[model samples]
Target: MRIYLVTPRNPESFWTYDRILPSLGKRCIFPNLSMPTVAGMTPRDHEIVLCDENVEEIDFDVEADIIGVTGYIVHKPRMLEIIAEFRRRGRFVVVGGPYASLCPEDLRGTCNVLFVDEAEETWPQFLADFARGAPQAEYRPAEKPDLTTSPTPRFDLLKVDQYHAMTIQFARGCPFNCEFCDIIVVYGRRPRVKGVPQVMAEIEECHRLGATQVFLVDDNFIGNKKLAKELLRTIATWSEAHGHPMYFNTEVSLNVAQDDELLELLRAARFTTIFIGIESPRKASLQETKKTQNMRGNLVDNVRKIQSYGIQVQAGMIVGFDADDESIFEEQLRFIQDARIPVSMTGMLQAMPKTPLHERMAKEGRLIAESVGDQFVFSNILPKAMSRIELYKGYRKLIAELYEFRNFRTRTLEFILNRGRQVGEGLAIRREELRLAARVLRDTVLSTSPRRAWFTLSLLGATLMKRPAAIADALAFAIVHKALYEYMQSLDHHLERVIGEIEAATETMTAAAVNA
Candidate 1:
């Protein structure tokens, strides 16, 4: 059998790091772990090829027995187009991943085979059936497969040099159920993780492939604390033994601040970054969205505590909610600045399919359209407190204020000053990272834009003076801020057009009602 695994292209957004990738000499941030893992699932006798559309163009004419496409909601439009192109070329097409798994009905007529939930068990079944000349239109597991037996991803298939980081998964599912989150719906709440040896092997594989930065890509790294500690301890030991060839990062709930031991294990394992969903500071919004974990403690203090352990906290914040009003935007902005989180990814609240929020919105007849996963530009649900136009305008204003040159610099500097010290191994910067840093510095120094040049140079000086050991990290933050500021600037025209259309439509309806 011949297989071609494809990951669709993502639109230019903060996560894409589109602007900075050029300076860093990378195609994308990282490859999605799904494709490589799926490649690993194929039989050894079969030929497998993998391509990330973000990094390379897809050849519709490729000679392959079957085409497998996977992506999140952000890539749905591109995924559909890719699948249609392949099927139009008379190739078998299969669709899966977060978007398909959450809303398979949306993909029903578009592809020959659709996979839902975990694919470890269903992928092999589909392969066997296809070989026998009879394949199911859809494959969904009756129960979640054991991750302990999951196969190591075929990282060899990926163009490692093109990516800035490598991706691996240590676990799936989250213990907490945030109403808008799709993880719990897809993976269940009982965190399932791979064996320690399996995880170490994946790490070793990544290291052997010249990957210095690896993302764990877990739904919540500490969802199961006991298991997570066990894994972290093993990782700490193995990383020390291997001279910390790869520094790790992952996502976790903010409740991790309460666990000092887990924080120690993470620092000991040389995990340099952790993304936490500090969705909102408003207690009402938190309760409305069922993200009570964030409300358990002082959000600002928790973030600082995490940073105190020398782990950079990249935050995820949302604005739209039933409990949010016009004032919520300022609240979010103030909270982000107060938290001193350098990379605060704020987006409009989206009612993703299969989540509790989506169901409630549907029941209330508030779902306006399917969410496209670009939170800055789109929101599917009609808010209870503000009109759609108002929501969009407020969100745009909030983003502008948050990423404004002065504010961005202040927060970034504060973070660096408070980022604390690295307590464990892996302190030395790798040769590749130094090269990236030099490139970043050179680009910023040569930049024609005054705001960008000042932002990087100013941050560079402060980091050099206060935390010289973190000069590379400071440069990385400056690059990300540059990407985000440029991305927002690119969206201005499109956003204004969308808002104008909505406002015009609203006025038309209002005038018609008055005339009647």
Candidate 2:
């Protein structure tokens, strides 16, 4: 069968350097990991063509016996549109991925077959069943397959030139079950890791394919600390033998600070950055969400210790929580500043489908009377203590304050100053640092709005002339913040549409009631 595997285009968000990524010369961030994995799952004899719209355009007229698309919550609308288009052309459409697996009802009658959970254990069976003209309404894994059996992703199907970095998964699942997180629900609590040899082999393949940076897209890369350390040690040796061609990045728990040996291994392997989920600093909120990792010690100090090894930390922060009151916004912003975290992914708490929080909200009658599709565009569910409007307003205020060109620049400079000093750096090291610094300044200046040009100019002058050390620390901060600013702006537009729809629906309901 001629199969067309696709990663749908996200109409609401597009890769634009002018919006969020000023420092990156590349057009897009990363290829969609799931579609490629699904392609790998297909039988070898079947002819398959993969198209990731992030890297290339989709040819709607392409002939195929089957059309497969995968995505997460944010890309639901686009995924549905692709399925609808294929169905309109009278083609068999298979929908799967985190979103579809969690909310099968979203594609109820549109998709011919829905594959839930990991496809590694069930996709081959699905292929055989489909080829025999016995397609089932739903396909589910009887058990999560062992990681050792999973094959390397079909990276050759990707447009290597379009993405900033390549991705590889070393582990599946996370140990922590934070109330707002869907990782445990999807992948389970007991972490499953790929063998050390298997992981290195994948890294070697990425190197062969010209990937300079590899993102370990695991929910928690170090969920299995012993395995992670072993892998990093092996990767360090590989880097030594291969002339250090690629740098690594991944997400991990805050407890990474407790292990000096692990940090050293990561540094030796050229692990440049790590994303830590420091959800919130408020101990009450942390306990409420079951994220005890942040409550162990000084969260800011733990991050600073990681940064001391020259591994940059990108922290994730969420604003809405049951325990949080209106003051949470200021608290979160202050926490970001106090921690001196360069890049922060701040979003309002969203209760994704099939999660513990989602079920609890539904049970409490707190879930807004809206469809799953509506939840993706905006924060549909409200917190127990706060009104929907308050949450919306707080989120907007925090985003505007953080992304304000002047405030961002000033905070970045302060973070740099806080990073004491680096002694005994060679000319080569200094030159590379200077280049990164220059790129950050240029990106920040170009990406900000015209109204903030004055602040940008002032920052550029201070960074280049007055504070050389500050430039080094602020570079990564500016790159991520610029991207986030553009993303928030897009969200603002989306929120407006959602609000308009709500108002229209409310007015219609009121009129109908009056007439009755």
- lDDT tens digits, residues 1-516, model 2? 888998876543423343543365555677778877887777778888998886678888899988898988777778878888888888888988888777778777888999888999778888888889998989888887799888888888777766778999999999888987888988999899999998888888888888878999999998999999999999989987876777799999999998999888888888878999898888998998889978988987888888777677788888778888889988888878767675677776777777887888888887774334333246657676776656766776776777766667766665565543332211134444466556766656665566544555665567767666445444555566556667767777766666666667768988999999
Deviation in angstroms for 81 in model 1? 1.6
Q: Per-prediction count of colliding residue pairs?
A: 0, 1
Which predicted model would earn the best lDDT?
Answer: 1
Residue 183 in candidate 1, Cα distance off native in Å = 1.1
Best by TM-score: 1
TM-score of each: 0.97, 0.87
* Stretches of model 1 off by over 4 angstroms after superposition: 423-428
**Predicted structure 1, TM vs. truth:** 0.97
Q: Candidate 1: lDDT over CA atoms?
A: 0.89
Lowest lDDT sum, 10 consecutive residues, model 2, at 420-429
Model 2 accuracy (lDDT, Cα): 0.76
